[model samples]
Target: MTGTAGDVIRIAKSQVGYHEGYSGGHWTNLQKYSPAVPGLEWSQNQAWCATFAAWCFQEAGMPKGSYPVTASCALGVSWWENAGRFSDYPGIGAQVFFGSGGGSHTGLVYAYDADFIYTAEGNTNSSGSAEGDGVYLKKRARRDTYVYGYGYPSYPTGIVTADPAWKNPTAPSQQEEAVALTDDDIKKIGRQVVTGANGAKSPDDPTVEWAMSSFLGLTYKTARTIAADVAAVKAKVESLSVGGVDLDALAEKVADKLAARLAE
Candidate 1:
C-alpha cells in the first residue's frame, strides 16, 4: 500500500537512537540505509543526513521517482527544485535542507509551528552539528540562518503545501472541468434537449447526460414529456399568428425564456 506523510514521520521517529558502528579502523556507516539506495554505498561513513531522509521516504513506500534518493543535501535540493516541488514553507514529512545553499545537512520535518520546525535527523547530536553521531529529533527556529527550505514529495495520496501557486495533486483533471455547466448553460442545453438537437436518437454525450440527470434531476421519461409539451405549445402558437408578426419565432423565443426560468 502507498504510505502517507504520517508513515514517513513514524518510520523516522522509530530510528531516533540509531548510531553508526565502528569497523576497519574508522567510523564505518555500516547502516541499513546506505545499501537501500543505489550509488549510495560509497557514502558510508560520510555525512548521512540526506541518506537518512532518503531511507525514511523509501521505507514509507514512496516510489523511487516520487522522492529524491541521494547522499548529498545539495543534490537533493536540486532534485526537488528541478521537479518544481521545492518550497520555502515547511510541510509535514517534507525533506528539510540546512546550511549554506541547503547543502550541509538534511532531515525530515515532522512538525512545525509559527516559530519553530521540528525534525528527525541522522548524524546529529545535542549541538546539532552537520556531521555528528546518531539519529535525533531536533527543534530549530523557523527563521534560523542554517534552515534553507523544504523538498516536498509527491505522495500517491496527495501533497499539502503552503505555496498557493501549487494546486492539490489529486484534483480533477481539465477534462472534468470542461463539462461543468453554469445555470445559463444548462438552460441552453434544456432547449436543445426539448428540440432534439442534442441527438436524442443517438448515444448522448455522457457529460451532458450527467449534467441533466444529476444537476437538473431529469430522467429519460421526464425529458420526453418536456419535448412533447414544447411541440404541442409550438403547434398551437403557429396557428395563432397575430397581424404580420412571426408567431413561430415568437413562440421559440418565449420557450427559451421559460426554459431559462425553469432551470433556476
Candidate 2:
C-alpha cells in the first residue's frame, strides 16, 4: 500500500520471473518451487490468498501479520468487517475476493486493463503444478463477466476494502472460490482417523492434510503443516500403488468437503 501500482507490478514481475513452473502437488513443492529459483524465495502455498499475501509481504520486507482480521483484504470484494486495509479501495496491491461463503480464492490485485484485471496467483488450475502452468499471469474479466466486485484499504488498512463495480447478478459459486481452511483446522477433524500416535505430535496423516492445505492457501503455522504432509506423501509415494485417484473424483471430494463445512 505504501508504493505505487507500478511498484507492485514490478515486484510481481520480478517474482514471476524467478521460477520454472512445476506440477503444483505435494504442498511442499512450493518450498523448492519458489526460493530455489530467484525472486520468490518466500512465495508459498497458504490457506488462502490473504495468507499468501501475508507471506509475500514478509518476503518483500512489508510488515506482516500486523492485523489479524485484515486478511480479508486479500480477496476481491473485501467486506472490511474487520478494521484493516483494502476495506476501502481497489488498488494494485489489494486482495481480491470473489463469491460468497466459507472460503474464496485470494489473489494479489496485480495489473488491470480498462476491462479486465490481471492477477498473480499461486494455486489455481487443475494440474496443481507449481509455477502455475508455466504462465505467470491470469486475467479476470472486469466488465461483462462475473467480476463480483473490487476493494481497497482505508484505515490502518493493510488489506483491501470493497468497491462495487460489476453489474453481473450471478456471483461465482462457493465451490468456484472455496479452498480448505488451514492445515491445523483440517487436522482437527482428521483426528478421528489417527490410531498409533502418542502425544508426541498430531497423528493425523500429513499427506491428506498437505494436499488439502495446499489446495487452500498456505497460512502460517498451517503452511509448515503442509510441508510435513508433503514429506509424508513423497515418503510413501513409491510404496503406494496407483489406483482410482481420478481427478473428477478428487474434485467431487473437495466439493463435498467444502459443501459440508460451509453448511456447518
Candidate 3:
C-alpha cells in the first residue's frame, strides 16, 4: 500500500477486510488489525497505527521521512517538526510529528473518522494485542497551533481535493524537502505547456509527473522519473536548437509558471 490518503482506503481495507461507510472519505475498517509489512512493523497495539501508515507510504516508495507525521500532530506538518516551520498538514502519506507540537517523536497516519485521524505509531506506551497491547487506532485531538492540524501537502500522491468539513486535521498541510511546492504551485506549471500540451511533445512536460504527485514529495519511482524528465526536457529543448528557447530561460519560465500557481 502507498502512503497516500488515496492509499488509506486500500491499506485500511487490507487490514480491516471490509468497510461500509464514508464520513467524507473516512473509511472505518471493521476494526480488524493486521501487521504492517516486514520492512516496517505495525505489529504492535497502542501505536502500531502510525507504523502501519508509515509502511504504506514506505511501500508507496515515498521518502522515508517527510514530517508532519502522526506523532507530531501537535506540530502540524513540516519537514522537521523539531526544526520548526510547523503547523501544516499537506495530506495523507506524511510522517506526522506527534505530541504537544514540539513534544514527542514521529508517527504515520493510518485512518481517520470525521474529526480525527487514526495513527499507526510504534507506541512506547503499549505493544500489541499479542502482548496484550496490540497496535490500535487513536483519534487525534486538535490543537490550533496548526502543528497537528491536517495532512502534509507534499505527499507523492497528495492531491488538493476540496476540504470537507469531515475528517481530522480539517485541511491539507504544508511541508517540503529541498524545495517547497504546493497543489496550486503545480497547476501553474501545467498551464505553461500551452504551446505543446495538445501536441504529443507536451506529454513530456517537465512538471507532469510532479504535477501528478500534486507537487508533494517524490516517490522512489517518481524520483527517477523526475531526473529523467529533467534530462529529457534539457535535451529536447537543446535539440530544438531554437535560439529563442534559452535553456536558462526555459527553466525560468517553468519557475515562473510554478510561482504564479503558488501565488494562487
Candidate 4:
C-alpha cells in the first residue's frame, strides 16, 4: 500500500525523544542510517531537521523526490513552492519552515489550532530553537514571525489545506469553486481589510479580531498586530453619537464593508 500522511506522522511521533550523540558533534541515529538511502549519506553530523523529515517519509514508504531530501530548510521550501505544493496554512504531515527566509529550521506539522501549531521536529530542543539537539514535539504560536510557511507532501490520499485554491480531494462538494489566491493575495487582503477598518486602526474587539482572523486564515495575533492602532481609536468610536445612531449597528456595517472588500 502507498504511504499516507498518517504513516509519516506516526513514524515521526515514535522518534520524539531520540537525541543526538553526547559528544560526537551532532551525530544522530539518522546519520547512522542515512547510508541506507543513496544521496542521503551526507547528513551525518550537520543539521538534521530536514534529514529527519526525509527519513520519516522514507520509512513510511513515500516515494523519493515526492519530498525534498536535503539538510537545508530553505531548499525544502523551494522544492514545495516550485511544485505548487506550498501553502500558508498548516496541514497534517506538512513540513513547517522557520526563521529568516524560511532557511533556519524545519519540522513536520502534526496539528494546528486557531492560535498555535504543533510540530514533530528533529534537531530542536525544549525551547524549540531551529538549531538544537534531539527530536521534540513543539507547540508554537501560529503568528510567530519565525514561522514562514508550510510545505505539503503529495500524499496518495490527497492534501488538505486552508488555501481556497488547494481544495481537499476528499471533500470536493463542500468546497466552493473559486479562484486560487496566491500567498501574496491573502496577506495583502488581510492587511488591507484589518488596517482599513476604523480608518487606519484595527478594531480592538476580540470578536472582530477573531472573525477577521478566521476569515483570512491568519492567526489572531497577526490580525491584532496588523491593526496595532485599534486601542487608540476604540474610545473615540465608542464615544461618538450622531443623531442617535446605534454603535452596534455601525460595527455591523463595518463588518459588511470588510466582507465586501474581501470579496473584491
Model 2 per-residue lDDT at 43: 40
List ranges where model 1 is wrong by over 4 Å.
22-28, 172-192, 195-264
Instruction: Give residue 247's error in model 1 in angstroms.
Output: 61
lDDT of each: 0.81, 0.45, 0.44, 0.79
lDDT digits (tens) for residues 92-160 of candidate 3: 434445445434434445544345555544332233221112233435643324234434434454444
Q: What is the TM-score of each predicted model, taking all chains together?
A: 0.64, 0.38, 0.33, 0.60
- Name the best candidate (by lDDT): 1
Q: Regarding lDDT, does 2 or 3 come out ahead?
A: 2
lDDT at residue 144 of model 3 (Cα atoms): 29
Error of 2 at 216 (Å): 75
Score candidate 1 by TM-score against the native: 0.64
lDDT per residue for candidate 4 within 137-162, as digits (tens), equals 99999888989999989898786555
lDDT of 1 by residue, 1-264 (tens): 367898899999999999888666765666777877786877776788888888888888888788777899999999999999898988888899998999999998899888999999998887898887789999999899889999988875566665567665577667887887898886776756743644554334565565555645556666777778778776767677655778768868877966974575
- Candidate 2 error regions (>4 Å): 1-7, 17-29, 32-49, 65-79, 84-89, 125-135, 143-148, 151-264
Please give the range of 10 consecutive residues that has the lowest summed lDDT in model 2.
153-162
Candidate 4 local accuracy as lDDT? Answer: 0.79
TM-score quality measure for candidate 3: 0.33
| Cα misplacement distance, residue 119 of candidate 3 (Å) | 4.1
What tens digits encode model 2's per-residue C-alpha lDDT throughout 183-227? Answer: 777666555443233232444556545544554564566657656
On the 0 to 100 scale, the lDDT of residue 117 in model 2 is: 74
